[model samples]
Target chain A: MRQEHKETMKRRRRNIKLTVAYDGTAYHGFQRQNKCVAVQNVLEEILPAVFGDSIEIAAAGRTDAGVHARGQVVNFFSDGMIPIENIPKAANRLLPKDIVVTEAQEADRDFSALHSAKSKIYVYQLYHSKVPDPLLHRYSWQYEYKLCLADMRKALTLVTGEHDFSAFRAAGGALGMNPVRTIYEAECKQEGAMLTFRFWGNGFLYHMVRNIVGTVVKVGNGRLSPDNFAEIMQAKDRNKAGKTAPARGLTLWHVNY
Target chain B: MRQEHKETMKRRRRNIKLTVAYDGTAYHGFQRQNKCVAVQNVLEEILPAVFGDSIEIAAAGRTDAGVHARGQVVNFFSDGMIPIENIPKAANRLLPKDIVVTEAQEADRDFSALHSAKSKIYVYQLYHSKVPDPLLHRYSWQYEYKLCLADMRKALTLVTGEHDFSAFRAAGGALGMNPVRTIYEAECKQEGAMLTFRFWGNGFLYHMVRNIVGTVVKVGNGRLSPDNFAEIMQAKDRNKAGKTAPARGLTLWHVNY
Candidate 1:
């Protein structure tokens, strides 16, 4: 009877992973908050009703306020027997129109959506235009000035591979945290008025992508040269970087397990 | 003195044209409403403040609620002398984030934005997926079933050329309105999960694009045949067609001079 009860407990506690996508325009952020609504709070509040289980979710990244995610991964142990295929549809029925659970899968009990991820890809979108575009405002930033794509490309090459990114960290980041991170790839692509910056890294420090974009925009606008960009990276001081770009322009694009 | 005053009045009544774009998710519709906020209400209220004159605007199309527009045209008479180049910038400063005046130009005094348009183009967007996509919910309709694009394309050809389209007109449209209209072009393009239908026409009947889209989607899903679509067009009966697709999927793409 003891062994049977233990097996039943093991069967009940299944680790389920969900791939979430959100507009992020309405939520304060992906993390839970006290007074303000966040993506995390919505998920936790709504998921229990769908799965009939008390739940806690661990997300791959805690995106800041106004930040969006297309392939955000989260894992939680479920005490209910809802079929894996039905999870997305069930959760989506209860979630708001801005948030969606795109996919769900059962994983090994030890799988961690945060720690077990190998890398993540983030994309920052901006459009060069004299006037704002309403359709693109929720997903992209608008810059009135023209950007030199060649200069931005040259500066992007400096961000590849492992390097100390302390200069790119925001002011309120944890003290004594490791500032070195491996950026497998960094690229800039332009199509007409739109510019996209893609970054693939093992892990990113707080506000790292926005800082890099800000400093890179400076280079694109001829305020800083590629050499100056290199110097800022080597300085390892937050004050050496340019202003942080707005959160709405960045999206957590994908995560690799 | 009387002659001079007449000349001054003529000069002050210069006609101006604006190319407008908006994300219509929050608006009631393009036309002004008694109590509900609308795109027209926002524009009429703000443009007058920018131009320093009481303004009246005539738009190229009156889009329904939740329908977006990328190149809606509007013509208005301005008594003030603001530089044409600065009009977009000045108006955008006071306009809400969801609406923008993209361009401004002086037009002929007799030019009418609604009556002088040669043709207009509208696009309907939809995506086939098992689960809803949060990023696209505002701009596209999500269909859970697979669509046969080839069949949809075949049916779209029937929509081209001059036709009496009373069957596609929505209820409450002007009674005894002429149903004969020229469809300059009708085409469908599919990429991945997205399907876009483009209609270029001299003029579309009320809910014509939406009603056609509803019928075409039914054809794509195998509920109706291309022959059935042709018969519906010939029937000139609203009851013969499928349901009107949601307004969110339709966009006023452009207007030709």
Candidate 2:
């Protein structure tokens, strides 16, 4: 790094961190896309209007379409003089109703929303009912048949700790990316007709959480035993896992720094 | 009643009751309107398709535009041969995604959904936040100011029991209708930033619940005292009450027969 460029960057207020929450049903995804509206596109357009400076942001996770987030981290560099406390308030007013800037703060010059050390917690929601609920359809998957909660619990227990998750990664994932990741916690809890599966992990491959949820649901439905789930994990083949669950059921719950 | 009309009505199967749940954002209201789409319009259209006979339904309440319902009750006389259990399943398949038939059953020959002796429960939802939540804005009213819970509770106590609630009635209410009604239960409960006001009553005059809510909110925000709220009720004039809260925050919770 050039000393002059480093000194220039250090003297200016360059890094701003923001926590965002969004309803992803109207967005294409978290990343910017040329042909479709994305969360990033809206953020980039609104931040400039709020801060009086064009800004580019880096996000912790690029969530897929129809996947909501309650605590998505983002960071950008801006020399504009808006107070950190007012950024979220100002941005929220100008941004579309589907996106919100929940928190904002000044950060160290070199900090990055993407490169920051962190683990994430994701939750997949499901409700078992003979008839679907109109109010909950946007946020949860409605499954008609009764599930074997005991069998699904066993399947989740096998999902904890480090493993090569090749069997769960979707195609078109980054080339040459490592498939091994550590899963700190994987558990399912049911209350009456509603069920929630929460997964906390250091990192996850594309579609890993959804694929695992789909496979665990099959076990709950008695199509496969706990042993079969273990075997699929050991096989380390994407074809061995079940189909990915619908995107509407998934929510990026939080990120732990 | 004529003997032949009575015998023919008694001999045929009739009076099927339905408990419906709907996301009312897409519909103008629960009643059929000439120019705009409504929940009743959709229900009336879809019921005939499912029962193979034209059906006219009577509802317990006529909810206003953008007002939701969790357990709104309706009844229709049908001579069709579809089994009782299959009615909901068949209607659900034919109904729009925003409306659902949650339960259906057989009712007595003389059942009249609107005229049946019954009470009703209504719930109004609110959340206090500096920034509006896009996801919850459709279902809950977002108030930015802090509320005095103690004052709100005091106002709710005064709302119970039978009273001539003309102060809370809106314009265009039924002509010559009795304004006095019995409120069996009236209470407000708060959890964190969320507040829910529930009213169980023999009947509600048009806009009575919403007008009372708006007036009580004034007391909570220090604009009016609890004594002022009681005075408003005593005034027995609509102009003495506060404005009506938005329709989005109100829901027809349930009907008791």
Q: Against the true structure, whose TM-score is highest?
A: 1
TM-score of each candidate's B chain against the true B chain: 0.95, 0.94
Best candidate according to lDDT = 1
**Model 1: lDDT to the true structure:** 0.90
Task: Supply DockQ values for each candidate.
Answer: 0.81, 0.62
Indicate the docking level reached by candidate 1.
Answer: high
* Candidate 1 structure, TM-score to reference: 0.95
Candidate 2 docking class: medium
lDDT of 2 by residue, A9-101 (tens): 456566898888888888998999999999999999889988777777889899999998888999887788988898888998899877888
In model 2, state the lDDT of residue A32.
95
How do the residues B1-257 of candidate 1 rate in per-residue lDDT, one tens digit apiece? 97785455456667899999999999998999989988999999998778888777889999999999999999887787888998988999899889999989899987889999999999999878887888789999888886888899888999999999998999879868898999988998889888898999999999999999999999999998999999999988899798999999899999999
What fnat does each of the candidate structures reach? 0.97, 0.67
Q: For residues A20-100, could you state the per-residue lDDT of candidate 1 as single tens digits?
A: 999898999999999999999999999999788767788999999999999999998778788999888889989999999
CA RMSD of each candidate after superposition: 3.9, 3.3
C-alpha lDDT values of all predictions: 0.90, 0.88
